[model samples]
Target chain A: MERKNLVEMVNIHKWFSGVCALRGVDFSVGYGEVVGLVGDNGAGKSTLIKILSGVYPPDEGKIYFEGKECHFSSPREARMLGIETIYQEAAMVPKMSVMRNIFMGRELARFRVGPLAYLDIPRMEEESMKALERVDLRLRSPHAPVDELSGGQRQGVAIARAMYFKSKLVILDEPTNNLSVKESERVLEFIRELKKQGISSIFISHNLYHVYPVADRIVVLSHGEKIGDFRKEETSVEEITKLMVLP
Target chain B: MRHTLLFTLRRALLLREISSLIMLLVVILVFFALSPLFLSRENVGVVLEIIPELGIVALGVTMLMIAGEFDLSVGSLFAFCPIMISLFVSEGIHPILSIVLALLLSLLLGGLNGFVTLYFGIPSFITTLGTMLIWRGAVLLISGGWPPPFSSALPTAFLVGRMGIFRASILWFAGITVLLWFVLERTDFGNWMFATGGNQVAARAMGIDTGKVKLANFMLCSLLAGFAGVIQSFRLETTLPSMGGGLEMEAIAATVIGGTALSGGVGTVIGTVIGSFLIRIIDNGLVMARAPSYWFRVFIGIATILAVILNTFVRERARKMRC
Candidate 1:
């Protein structure tokens, strides 16, 4: 069986001021594929994903989503096309309730009269709980602020939100960082669940152990360039780690 | 069992205005004990009448603060709008047209503030401070240090008419409060404001137009300040270049005392309403008790700090509670 690519970035290049961040890096993810993107700090993993997520534009390159070339001017534009990116330390609003954070930009309105509509609070609360349950995250109330939740729980909420929104490509940047052992296990499980549901995910992390079990393929970057791309069956953890640290 | 009680207490405090409400009651009682005239009809009327002038401005400031921005120029806009309205009317413009023109000017000034701040990435505190001085100087330049006489052709009954121990401005104040409260609590824009203020990076990642949200709030804050000034001018029948001079600080104080977070992303309109009343009552109560007028500022400073400490204490305890 042949799987079609859900996302394709050809020769993407990015620059900040006078410094080069990414130099002609090519990346792609197939439908229902979980790709582990690992790199050192400033390996341009965050920068690459930021460009794909429409946080900014690539200096040179073309992006094709579902076989169609697309340009996104803002994160909102990419979101409308079903690309949900959860950034490292940029997932949930700390002071907002779990339910509110889940429905932050795309709120459920009971009745909208030209941007003057009341929130469907009951529906949102119920839907958020169901979404959290899907990620196996249980809380006493959805109204509790995200600040009180553990790092793992916060990631759970972010994952639950992506699941609820029915995103085609969910990009998670270091979703397991600062998490306890149990919490990180839960997050890896979430990636497995996302694949089970036929959703493509790009999991960016620094830890190969965390990404190995869940990713179907591994892509390695070092100093703003791709050095290795291999199937999980062909590549061992040590091989990828060596490539990541290579001068 | 003890946990449930603590949970309930936390929920009650999460409402965010309870402490301010309690302070308001305490202040009322203290003044009532200190002076026989504390609750006199005239003194109560005076307090109620003036509260809306500042209350309306505070409402807008609360929304702006919740969106993680500031508008120190609101005080200047408060004076500038009315002065503009009076100038237009004297120039033979219809009274209604004059009011509309003044509000439009407010939005323009607000938009400029928002544009400069967001585009240049300057902190709103500095952007609005610069605009504050500019607008204040513009007002003085336009008015030439004298009050402008306002004789609107429109009926005074429509605006500040006496409504039996309350001026119509109180109704406007109440109406604006309800409108803004609904906008903040029940609407998508309100949620956006909270998310924007709560965490800009997170909000942006979630696909929110945080810049647009903050910009709208900046304009709204100025519009309300202008409208409140118009209301005041109608009551006074003149526009003072020095009107709303120190009002910006008072409005910010009201928001802080009402439990709105100084850092943004946490606030409530109802809390601000209570906060506005608390500030006005304290001012009126002291005067009725024959205390020095300077005591108002001293007392407000203390109350602001106490309210913040109380709110912080309650919030920290709530956060530590096990779910």
Candidate 2:
């Protein structure tokens, strides 16, 4: 039985300064399935994902999220459709406390006094603590600044935020980049947690070893085109690496 | 138990304003010891009077600095606003109506500053610096480079009247501070402001309109500066072309001394008040001590630098003490 697709990008084309970045690429991610997107530098992987995540408009193509055709002008629009993208660095304010970072734009407010709404600090702090715990990050306090957290822990907080928001599909861009070996394993464990919760993920990475273990299916891009797509059991790691390296 | 005690002490001392608070105390004590008249009721009143005018302007600067913007135009607006009001009042408009018109004029000037900074994508310092020069020059052209004298009986009595030891301007300063403090600490807009200043990219990623937050802060900064100028002019019954000259730096200094980071995202309104008061007290003490008036600027520069250094030392030590 074929799995239902949560997101579908059909015949997508993108260009920049008369240069083709993506040419007629078709990609889809099924519900609760991990699709590892592997490519060398300048292989159009980043452009394709940016289009799907609404960072840029596709020159030609249609995107369907949850079977509904969607056009997103900004990342916020994509996020509203339950798609959260965690770019490398986890994209958090360093000076703000962990809890504040978790609920940065979407703050919980209580007791409307005239035109002002007081922030519900206790509730946010409690929820932030639980989210951090769910991702298995043991920080000293929710009040600690994000800059103090280890790289792995920071990624965990981003994952925890996505999880708590109940995003249907999360796109992790180089999630394990610059992380320790143990930290990479922790991120792998997080992907497992997402899978257990019936959420789909698009894991983009340069390392085949990292992608091969958790991916249900693999998609390879080379020189601005889709080169290959293979199921985990059918394709060997060497084959995928060859597809990535040899255009 | 001992570990917890050390932890608690470090945490308390590590706050951005604690060092400033200690420094303020030391300065006041030193002044009191050096001069018998430093603690006199009349001298205390003098410090209180000067503090509120600069303090009100500093409050607005504190928020803008935290939101990661600057308005050098504040000093210019402070000089220009009252002149505009007196011009209208002399032209047969009621003083009340003139004040209203002046504030509206201030809003327009502020909006212009904000628009150029946001829409054109120029740094606020450059935009406001341009505005500073424009408004100051405009005031000079309008007033013929001379101070204008115009007084309203009821308005002056109400705004500058003595409320026992403290003046009405001091009340205005304190009231505005409390209102702003609540807004900064308790409101969603306040949080967004911090996020915008702390990290614009991340804040935008989180779906915040950082540009809007910054524009609003610029407007607020101008409005407060204008309001402070109106109050000062009403009390003095004259709008000096030189009035508020070099005040922008003083307000910025007060903000930095009060523990607000020049980089933004880390400041408190109360801290700015203390910072403003500290500078005022020092200025007052220096005058009473018969120090050269230029000594005031020299001391302010030293205080600002020292406060930041001490605050950083305490913060780093606090982090190190933590497990």
Per TM-score, the best of the predicted structures is 2
* Candidate 2 lDDT score at position B214: 90
- Model 1 lDDT tens row, B98-182: 8889999999888999999999999999999999999999999999999977675855677799988999999999999999988
- Residue B61 lDDT in candidate 1: 94
* Candidate 2 docking quality: incorrect, acceptable, medium or high: medium
Write down the RMSD of candidate 1 (Cα, Å). Answer: 2.2
Please give the range of 10 consecutive residues that has the lowest summed lDDT in model 2 chain B: B149-158
Q: What is the lDDT of residue A141 in candidate 1?
A: 95
Clashing pairs in 1: none
lDDT score, candidate 1, position B288: 87
In angstroms, give how far residue B261 of model 1 lies from its true place: 1.3
The reply for model 2, stretches above 4 Å from the true place, is A1-3, A113-115
User: For residues A111-184, what per-residue lDDT tens digits would candidate 1 score against the true structure?
Assistant: 98785668999999999999999888899899988988888888888888999999999999998888888989
